[model samples]
Target: MLLRMPTSLSEAQRYLAEGAVPVGGATLVWALWQRDGFPEQAMSLRELPEATLIEREALGAAVLLHQVDDRVPDVLRRAASTVGTGAVRRTATVGGNIVGSTLRCLLPAALVLDARATVLDREGPYETDLAEVVAKRHLLLGLRWRDPVTSGYYKAPGEAGGPPPLVVATAVHTGSDGRHRLFVAVRDGYDVISETVPCHTGPDRALEALDDTGLGSLPAEAREAVRREVTGILGGPADR
Candidate 1:
């Protein structure tokens, strides 16, 4: 395969449109081989402009997000490690997979909160919903949002020797207006979205209930069961 390193994402996109696949810093040939065969182009994103927040904004009634940072979120890169063994982790990137919208990837983590992405659309620096941007395969510049309450992530193993990922659960919470903004994220096959609640509740009870529903295949019956089990053990504030 031929390697053509581009100085920017636009260059990479041009390469992709010209019948060459963009590749980042990872072991492209090996990662590609594990999936199919060889890649057409090995592209580099190091020189590409990084993402940063421009300003902080209120998400709902309760959350406040940091405006900007020149670096990628550490939690995102950490989450990518869940995809596979050391080989995959060595080369994977947070913005890379997130731009690609890999299920069980960083995008899900950000999506669970008040975060939103700002990208240059045909009009200009357009603010796109994370879910919508991923759906249309649009380019992502960066994301900004106030972090919610405590955040949790869970990963599962897949079949031996494959590129597929198995991540069961992810959640984020922040209290506002006397209510805990609860969000539960789960990956189903190829989709990752959150179930959020912005209402008053005991943090202890919420945390306890959340503990019981630990990752993977929790249907309605199971969700309720966990809720019940956790309530008993959880030391929570009495409802007003």
Candidate 2:
């Protein structure tokens, strides 16, 4: 396969339009290539200006997971910190985590935060919800969000060096009327449960939000773990 490193967003878009698959960290791309062959042409976004920006409310697609710090919202920071070993985290990119086929911990955090992604296609850059971008595997330029008042993330333990089966993330943000809005996202494998309600909603009500999420389809252990973690995160007593 031929790899082209584009230095500008337009150049990258042109390469991508010409059928070159976008590569961020290549952590997922390499794995896919080994298993099922990917596109013959690949464009590396590393040199583009959008690849390296990390700010108070915006993050470049190629920003390393290790670069996420206390300055960012708590939910994203905690999720990034727990993604992989130090070495793996150092090499993984935010965009890769978002668009990868694997069930990454960051997706739930992004969902709860109501993040928006700046995407570059053949036309140009356009802002859209992060979840849509993730679903379509679009070429991402950056991500932006309104910093939440409070947020947290929890990843259930699976096995050493393996991805967890369940993760829960919550965020509280003040809306235009000065009332707090609570957002919760639970990810189990590829299925997700996302809900938004008043910040004052009780823990029992929060757990009830999962009733329509098809939570029963998951394994018994994962179902219980999801309930336990969601309850604990909402300040409820753990199941006996």
Candidate 3:
């Protein structure tokens, strides 16, 4: 297979424009090979500096998962650590983590962060939310977000070293007037089955808003378990 390393963003864009499949860490490449055959041409994004940087609120697409564990917010760091073992973490890129496996550890955290992505296509770089990027199957160049006041993540693994059956992420921001904006995303396996942004004054009220979204759709036991897990993370129910 032809492997080309592009040293600049524009160069990478040209290669992608020419039909070269962009490769970050090759984690996704290998996974795809197991299902289909190898791709004809792969352009490596490792040489592009923008692909590996973690600037204030922007995360380059190719930044390694371990780098995120070391540099991002606590909630994201915790989520990054759950991605894989030490060795796997070393090789997996944040972009790969997001695009390669929907059920992986980063998506829910990014969702809670209200993250947006910059992507490159035939026209050029464009900005869009992570959800839109995923839906359109675009090539992600970077991620950007503003840190929240408080955030938490919880995952219920299906097995010892496998993808979780359920993953939940919550972020809360408070305004000066004492109102709170709570964002929550619940992923059942590979899909984010539910998402809600409810304005509330306390944890109990926030959860009550979530309940109104039909959390009952999940199995009764699973729903209760997730509730308990999230409650523990946010601290025992308390008044704002």
Ranking by lDDT: 2, 3, 1
Task: List per-prediction Cα lDDT, in the order shown.
Answer: 0.48, 0.77, 0.72
Q: For each candidate, what TM-score against the reference? A: 0.58, 0.82, 0.85
Best by TM-score: 3
Would you list the rank order by TM-score, best first? 3, 2, 1
The sequence of per-residue lDDT tens digits that candidate 1 reaches over residues 57-144 is 3111001122112132323333544544565555554445655535536665566545677654433346777777677755455676
- Candidate 2, residue 28: lDDT: 72
Q: Which stretches of candidate 3 lie over 4 Å from their true place?
A: 34-37, 160-163, 175-178, 214-216, 233-240
Off by over 4 Å in 1: 1-22, 25-43, 52-78, 101-104, 120-125, 161-178, 203-240
Candidate 2 structure quality by residue, lDDT tens digits, 127-231: 998768877888888888888877777777778756555787877778988976667778876777777766456556655755555554667776676566556
181-226: candidate 3 lDDT, tens digit per residue: 7667677766675455445555576677677775657767657765
How close is each model in CA RMSD to the real structure? 8.1, 4.3, 3.4
